[model samples]
Target chain A: MSSLAVGCRLRVAVLVLALLGAGAVGGGSTAHAADDGELTLDSIVNNVIVGHAEDGNYLNFDPFATVELPRIMVARTADGALTVDLYGSTKGLLKDGTYGLVPHSEGEGGHEEVITESSALQEAFASKAHLHGDIVRTSGHVVADLSITRHLIFGLLAMGIVLAIFLVLAQRYKRGVGRTEAPHGVLQNMMEVMVVFIRDEVAKPNIQGEKWRTFLPYLLSAFFFILMANILGLVPYAGAATSNIAVTGVLAVMTFVIGLLYGSKDHYKHMFLGPPDAPWPIRVILVPIELIGTVMRHLALAIRLFANMMGGSLIIFSLIGLVFIMNVLFGEAMAFGTSIISIGFTVFILLLKLLVAFIQAYVFTILSALFIGISVEEHEHEEHADDAHAEAPTSQTSGALSDRLDAVDDAVDDVTEPAPA
Target chain B: MTEVIAQSLVQPDVGLIFWKTIAFLIFLFLLYRYGWGPITEAMESREEEIESSIQRAEEALAEAKEIQSENKKARREAEREAQRILREARESAEELREEEMAKTRDRIQQMQEQAQAEIEREKQAALQELRDEVADLAIEAASKVVRDDLDGERQRKLVNDFIDDLPKN
Candidate 1:
């Protein structure tokens, strides 16, 4: 009990420290605010957004104070050989001569202008120097800025956590923890339940046949990864990797690739030629529509996950930003009063976000399964269909076939049955 | 504000994508190999074990039930056989008792007959003895009278005459 109290005290202390640090940054912005006549909404938006990969600034729970991540850039030198530049932080990169921070434009009223842009910055922008948080000289271009950003750090952290959990679970399984006997303890049981759920509920129902085994590993990994990332984001100082479009894009692309690569001939035939029974004119029209629809589905999968995660965080940030906005507009007393209302809404959204996190992960995983299922589905062709119909009566003598037919009949009867008098 | 928000929302950096893809793929591969593969396999095996164990238990229960029924049938048959043996024993015992009673009745009848026969034989013998005595007394009286009247020759002739007259009567 005493240890618990001490832990709570430590958390409170850290929260207080974070708030103080944020307050300093927020107060320091008043100098810029004085020049701009007043603090605009742009600052709040900028604070909420993850600006660029090269930007060392990370959005923390405190809202104002940002954590700087390490900057890494691979630039091509004049000799055409690759050179890697490493800095402890973005500030260190600015101190180095190879790259410079592009100035933010004050009145241009966009993310490009969120930071006051100087003439020198405009010149750099004209010269085609990439101004993504850090300037890369357009003449001697950088191969890739594989810098470790805040999101990347969080992403890796999420991966590390997932790996740690599963690796232990794997070891336990190797030692026959859940194999020969009933699984004991919360962790083992939880892992078993999730694995079973994904296999039985998600993969089996969607991706049917023996093929489910092939995709089960990928599906399980995607589900756990997304779930972990979403939950991590809800923590005080962590970010949701799925909130980034790029991450979701990569995930969606993987699903698309799997579908494209492993799709049955019938799958492609259906998409490209429509149903064989359809008229030629109708088939031609349907083919392009189906093709577009397939692409759109994949795109939607990525966007849906990304938007849901991003939107939840955005709402929470906007709610907290209201308190600061009130402080600027109505003085300290009104701002203090508004903090209660703002915090109330923020907490409410936070709870909703927690639910959304699980739901989005589920939605993403199930949809991927569905898409893969459709691609890999085996269907009896028209000729085979006729043959099956001819053989149906004879096949009915088999007990298994008859039982299956009975089940189907029962399902049909249930659907068609009227209300009892 | 909208432009700033839009830029933030829409911006995608190559570096982040590249890193994310790499990290995610690595995670997927590592977990697929070590984590998910073994875990799923374990769960599948566990399910199969449970199912087989239940089936085995059911089979054992059925066998036990079958054995119990067979035992009951044998016990019933043994009970019936014992009842039949007891009944046959009781019937033989009753027959033996009746035979002993008949033998005792025949022995009593034989003894009574023997006793009656002896009594009759004795009566006949006594009767004969009485008759002989009477005869002897009569003869003696007749001889005394004769001796007083005549001489020895005349007495002999009178006794012979009396024996002859008795023979004729």
Candidate 2:
């Protein structure tokens, strides 16, 4: 078995080297005509990273087969009128010539060359205007390009899958399938385990009290959506939606909104005025710090998830890119030798990325719960303290003063004994 | 190089975020209504069922244990009652045997006393007959002698006196 594995590894190394060799040769020949270097690290990064959407451009898993997604664009005409164009494919838009692909660089000349014909397919692709964020030309002026990018498509796909799975599970539960009987299939059982985990482990402990239930649906959706998006990104040509800062940002914003909306009077007071018992001098120093900390925490939440996911994919791409890099830098034989090491590291990192996918999802969910928990936490101790002070007797009567002292002691005991769990 | 990396890393498209938020909110609402709501309720109901079933089983086990102990107690009581009855029966049988033996002894003593009295009376009668016979004999003898000599009156007197002397002998 060990020998067989070694032989397989040897074969993979050879295959990788051959591919890299071909890429190196092809890239060298094409570099003169094309603005972008083919198969270079930058090209690989651009290909892997989140980019703007191009119409009808499918994710290219292989050179022969692709998964096509719809392109929706908002463009402006020569008269400064807005046009919303929906095309079945980027090829259709290119054929129409109402919109043209802008070049990445205009060379020494200051004029930007826009590709308008199907004959300029190579130049059009080099321009990459098919990507969602890149601006397209309508009568030689740049227009707003709000198209569905690759990551957005994958994000929607992930959401759809999550919805479909849980919807079925929900229907089964409603029909008394899982309710009255033991959960029948793997999908139902797994979904139940996850839901229960989120409820018991994530929501209950963090968001305390009945408020957890109100926030549970949001937490569950976010967790599953992120989890599905992360897993789907591992597929050959799919983009990780969580890897995109915009998606994570939106999630964080939602969490922030929920936190603010549900925040208790005490929560806001603590943020703006420090603790009520603290001296005036200390309050002045602490309030702004506390307020800024709240925003920063949410910001960190977004960036953490985005960075972890993007970092994992980037590492894997870099590892794979190393073979091509070595082929270009060193001789083909050296590149072939390096492929073995490169592929090994790539496989290892891929596994790590899978683990990171689940962890990041869990982290994001729990942190959101924690923030919500802090916001909604009731100030029972403070209320008890206030009640105790209110019942204290006036100092005009000496006997009543002693009784008031005892009352204060009893109140302190009451407050300390039933501290919130 | 760092700028390039940073730009790639932090790029947030406004359009994407807007659509994502809408999609996510719709998903959250739909799932809450149809997916999580029913699922969580079912799980909770199922958990309650399992808990109640366990409690009932425990109660039944406790009841069974109580009955078993009661049966044990009852069986022990019955065994004690049976032993007491057996002991009472043996004691009664012993008392009856003793009473019969005493009755038989008293009857034997009375019969021996009666037999002794009868023997005493028979002996006395025999003696009287013997005495009379002897007296008769003596008279006859006396008459024979007197016929050759004296009178009858003197013979009767002599016989009466002779009977009396013979009793003394």
Candidate 3:
């Protein structure tokens, strides 16, 4: 018990130190709200929260170091032909002079792109003036702005890492490492444990037997992909791709589409016809409610993951931003004192954020599998019952909880493999 | 659109969604084909192999037990057969010994009876002879008393003729 407490304290101290260091590095160049001398609420909102979470062109490591990625877009040219424009970076696109940035005349969403005459596009950005809005080559008619942004790169990195890891693992198994022989070393063992856990624990109980195998690939992909993205978000400069609603929304949509595609005949019946014994008057109200509920649940599945991930970064930033707010309110001495509390809360939130990272990934995956599970579920009726009697109706994700017992039995008999009881 | 990037964090931007869709689909496809599919297949096959191996082991154990029991039964039968053969042989030997002793006793009794009959015949012959000899001696003594008068030859001849007619004894 004492050791556990010490371990917790040690983690908190490490988190506090790491966040303080990050804050110190990020303090000087928040960019947007530096208009005023002090760190204001506007700075916290514009620079700290938005800047960390936004899908921008430049990969902002710190204010000092930023890497600009390529911009790609498709636009309808004035000649009435579709053209794809590519740039080395946003700077290259502006330098090309075919496109220029104008604050959206609509006044809200930042910048819009319009054609320029010369190779030296918008003369203002020709040199450099806060030109961070993704400007693609367009005649004020950008059909598709597929610009490679910071979040995309990090998202790809997370995905690439997943691919790299799994490819190697797959190859190892292909060579009969985990297949014929015992999975050796930490990497293989750890991953096999994770894969098996996802299969038995996440996929099995939530989705019934045999059916789980059909969706196993999708479920495993979502689980590990989200997990990888979430973990990447915890890294100091790397942000979570799942924090973006667009990304999570796309993921959720994938689930929605899969459920729609593979949903059973019974599932459609349940969706269209709400309940068996309802009066038509009540059924009229309930049917819409049920439909909306199904749609909302999936949508919430997306938003929940986005919100949890985004909320963590937001809270962490806000917690640390309080230090500066306190500095201006009181004095330098009070600011130093506030730093202690700021660091404390930031440490706690950071740890919670770490936990939430894994949790949100799990929640998103399980919820997705559940939605698909239900959509494909054969409704057990008095007439046509489900044949899967081995797995119970309301079984929870506790099947893998007995792996230790199976492992013990496995030792007693090598042939009796470690399948959960 | 001053905060275009800013709003993208919350709003589902069409451009970002397009890219996200492309990226996620590719990621999902690649992962399923290379990683998820093969991994699950390998694990499932391994589990099946293990299950079959366990079944075979159980079958083998049961067969061995059956063979062991069968061997024990066969051994017991062989022992019983040997004991039966030994007892029969002993019983036959005792009967043969009893029969041989009875046959030997009957033979001995028959031989004794034959010998006794022969002995009686010999005794009768001897008595006849004695009688003849006595009669011949008296005749001889009377003849001697009458001064050898006796027709000795005639007396012998008559005794011989009388013996031949009386008994082919």
Choose the strongest candidate by lDDT.
2
iRMS values for every prediction? 7.6, 7.2, 7.4
lDDT of 3 by residue, A199-281 (tens): 88778876755798888888888888888888888788888888888889998999999999999886777568755445578
Extract clashing residue pairs from model 3.
A97-A121, A104-B1, A109-B1, A109-B4, A110-B1, A110-B2, A110-B3, A111-B1
TM-score of each: 0.75, 0.77, 0.66
Instruction: Give lDDT: candidate 2, residue A360.
Output: 79
Best by TM-score: 2
- Stretches > 4 Å off in candidate 3: A1-39, A78-81, A102-139, A380-421, B1-6, B55-169
lDDT for model 2? 0.70
| Displacement of the residue A5 alpha carbon in candidate 1, Å | 49
Q: Write the per-residue lDDT of candidate 1 for residues A1-421, one digit (tens) a residue.
A: 1334323322322322243345454444444543554354344334433332112334444445645567778889877988888887655565455665545444343444222234554554443232235455444777887777677777788889989999998999889988887787899888777778888888897775889999988898899889898888788777788888878888999999999999988778777977555679999998998899789878988887777777676656656766665566456897799789879977877787777777777777877888898788766544436744454433232234236434543543352232100
lDDT of 2 by residue, B61-141 (tens): 999999999999999999999999999999999999999999989989998889888888887888788777776777678
Q: Score the docking of each candidate (DockQ).
A: 0.33, 0.33, 0.24
Candidate 1: where are CA atoms >4 Å away? Answer: A1-40, A48-67, A76-83, A109-134, A381-421, B109-169
Better of 2 and 3 by lDDT: 2
Q: Say which docking band candidate 2 falls in.
A: acceptable
- Across residues A1-421, which tens digit of lDDT does each residue of candidate 2 receive? 1334323322323333343555445344333323334544334333432222111145665556554455567767678877778776665666677777654441332556667777675455544444322336657353444556567788899999999999988889989987889988999988888889999998997775788989999999999999999998688767688888889999999999999998987678777977665678999998988788789878988987787777676666656766665655554897799789888977877777787777778888888887788777666544535744432331122234235434533543353232110
- The alpha-carbon lDDT assigned to residue B133 of candidate 1 equals 55
The deviation in Å at residue A318 for candidate 3 is 2.2
